[model samples]
Target: MRLRRLFLLLLCGLRAEIQEQDVRAMVGSDVRLGCTYPEGGSFDLNDLFVYWQIPVPGKPNTNSVVTYHLPENSSAGHSDSHYRDRAWLSPDRMRQGDFSLQLRNVTPQDEQKFNCLVFRKSLELKKILEVVVTLHVAANYSMPVVSGPSQDEELTFTCKSVNGYPRPNVYWINKTDNSLLDEALQNSTVSLNARGLYDVVSVLRVRRSPSVNVGCCIENVLLHQNLTSGQPEMFAGDKRSVTDGPAHDTLEAGNKPVFSVLGVLVVAVAVAAGWLCRHRCPHRSHAELV
Candidate 1:
């Protein structure tokens, strides 16, 4: 009987030693908070109440806000108003040693130290979790400069962007009517010329009525800020002229007076040729020939 009692004592001591809790996180634009507790503990989660609280900065020993709580089935408990829709408990997977808390639409206000409180029967145990969320804001992206010849000429545009975190996607925005024209003029090319920098060159064959406006937009997926520019500076070959607008002159419709003068000259020449043929003809009538 004494040996059995000693075995029971050893088992209880081992269980107590194994009851461990800790919090870990992966830091970045989106931060994750993790919580883990040893299994085979004396506490029953169903009989226990769980709560999360964040302490106010500069206010030591004072809890600023209650973020979340798991109320008893019979109690008409309520979640903190601020975290009503933002906080959620881990699923069954978490009960099996997975203590991950998913917070959606994370903001700067949510960055703080958090604590997880566990209450079972009349015993209370608490664990602290540190959460640090970094905000990544992308700067504005610049528009491209289109250059080259006018109608029936080769054209090129260079897209540029600056001050973007976590890199930016660069591409040419195209606008064409026909499918063939779209395929021929489409500039889906992209390249990262430098760190956090990008450039794309869009090239196409210029046709009649050659002027066109192209847009370059830089979008930040995390912040959802879009910056777009369509006014591209025109250039003639590798050199940029001091000219104040499109390199080519706008052509007007209809024929000029020069075309009319050329037509009149051709008519006058035809009449003179007919008169010369008549004068060269001899008097070769049928009676004269006999």
Candidate 2:
């Protein structure tokens, strides 16, 4: 009976060990790390102490530490200088079996194994939570370029730019007044060939006139309100003068009056012929005997 009792006690201890809590989490996002004792165990929040430490790679070692105690609801200790202001214990949710620690504005440097330890009246338990955080920082912005024929001629303008992190906001701007233009011309058709990367073409019809200046601007919506303009290009038609070409010939323009006069005379002759034929053969039927 003594041997049987000892075996039962050993089995019970093994079961308790298996029931202890564990921790797990992902990177660049929020995570919770804490411990829980078996139900009816002589343990409370005050009896447990929790902390996180980054362990050496493939070895049992640690260089940084963060410790927290309950009720006071504040960090009790920190071995790493970097985590001093960024790591803290969450007071509001810790008492309800939430040994979860809250780390804000997490950086890649904080990624590692975290040790959560619980102690009460000579009974002690420890769980290790592993953390992996990825670092992501967006690069610089690039201005869009506008290309094609000069503005004075009936021409198409194409705007293009590269895709960047945080997805930039791109649009066209009139350089003269610094005002925003319709994504494309109002009467023109606008096609967004690709998102992030884009090409938009706008056609403008201009009469014989002098060169005019225009600009195409691209902007980052989240970072700035001002726009970056493309190099100024003059309209080609604006460079021409009246004396540089032959005199404006209305006849060559297809507006000659002779065509209209001929059309009117033909209509008048047709009407007169119909009137004479009707009078001379009044009441005559083609099929009647002579």
Candidate 3:
């Protein structure tokens, strides 16, 4: 009978935790880390204690996110400097057994495993629950910008995007036929910036031809989205082709006509309006806007 009583006491003293969970958050957004307790309630505020912490690699001490001693509801004195004003808990929700955390403006650096521990006081503080939450962070890349051959250059185009998370794929498309250009004819590179974001650059070269229309695409697998920008339909041949290149340049410049043609059209419109005004209003003086 004494052995059975000892077994009961051991079992009663041992506590178990729920399985770990995963959460996905986007960069520059807010997220809630879920945690709860059956008895982290207001019934006995003096007995409840909640703590949120993150384990740092190669460090003996963990980083404190927030700590609440139910009796006082005070933040941990030694909270990590990086998380200051960004991580917080709600006292009103704690009154209803909710000890979740609210994290604001989550960045790529915020990706980590968080530990939530709850303690109940009796003769002393006794751990009652532990929850682990893993956070995965992601961000969308900016729209691609494409630059093509200059007036005196060959048919080389560049496409670039910035402020993306993770590396992304790059492709060159012949917008004339909607077909992807050969990968061998393109060079692509991706690099990480100081802010932990990615920047992508790609260059594509096309053969000398009479006309060419090309597009550059950036594919972010993490965000499952793509951005594309097409060239303004530039020329592809030698100096002799330069004679006709300005036509394409004109089209790219918002379909602006040549100066001579624009001047002639303006003169014709002014003459027509003057004639109409003199004939319609016979008593008016013979004066035109031109």
Candidate 4:
């Protein structure tokens, strides 16, 4: 009987080793880290304690995010100042064995590994359970802004997107034809802002060509979404091609012919209206009226 009880106890302890979990959160949103006791044991709320923490970069010590103690029936003062007002645990649900932490107003800095620990105590007995969760924060990027293909011999244009997380990528696309551009034509740079969001810019330099339609695209790999500015369909170049490549000058050149055709049609419509009125209206003889 003693050996059997020891074997069951060992199995229970092994079960408490919580499996790692992955969490993805968006910037400026709230996130929840889930932790709960495994089956085979009831959680005693009278002497329960829960703690959530994250590893400090380049330091041996971990940073305290939040903590809850049921014995005191209070849970506000135990967290680090950085997460004092932002982290929360539900006392009511905790009574039912839920010890999740809800983190509010998440930012890029919140992307890290979070450790959850639960402690329970009874007369002459104590137990602890741990769970490690990896959190990834994503921020959507704005549409890439493409500016300038200077009318000089060598056209130069710049593309930029701000306030993105995990470092978004920017590249030049041939709007004239839906295809990737040559790597030589694009130069990209990424920088982080004070808030930890990424700022990206790309410069494109190519020889001046009237048939080339170009645009810039920004993509967030985490979200699997991309946005492009100055689409090729807005230009009048090649209708059959998927990508467009041209500057405003070429677009205007394409527009002049279309406008000229419209001008001629308007003049013909005015002449026809005048001719119809003259022939269809009833005319009184000038001699009889006099």
What does the lDDT read for residue 54 in candidate 2?
48
Model 2 whole-model lDDT (C-alpha atoms): 0.39
lDDT at 66 for candidate 3? 47
Worst 10 residues of 2 by lDDT: 241-250
TM-score of each: 0.33, 0.32, 0.66, 0.71
Q: Please list the residue runs of candidate 4 whose C-alpha ends up more than 4 Å from where it truly belongs after superposition.
A: 1-15, 40-42, 61-65, 123-125, 231-250, 254-290
Residue 6 of model 2 has an lDDT of 24
Choose 3 or 4, whichever is better by TM-score: 4
Global local distance difference test of model 1: 0.39
- Error (Å) of candidate 3 at residue 263 is 26
Write down the lDDT of every candidate, Cα atoms only: 0.39, 0.39, 0.63, 0.63
**Ranking, TM-score, top scorer first:** 4, 3, 1, 2
Candidate 4, residues 83-152, lDDT tens digits: the string is 7778888776676777788889998988888887665645222345778889899997665566665556
**Candidate 3 residue lDDT tens string, 1-290:** 83344223323544546548799888899999988775544635556666677876788653444433445545432257777788887776766777787889998887888877666656354566677889888887775666656544346666777888767777777656556777778899899888888888887766655556666666666566666653544433432211111111113433432455576666765564344223311222221111
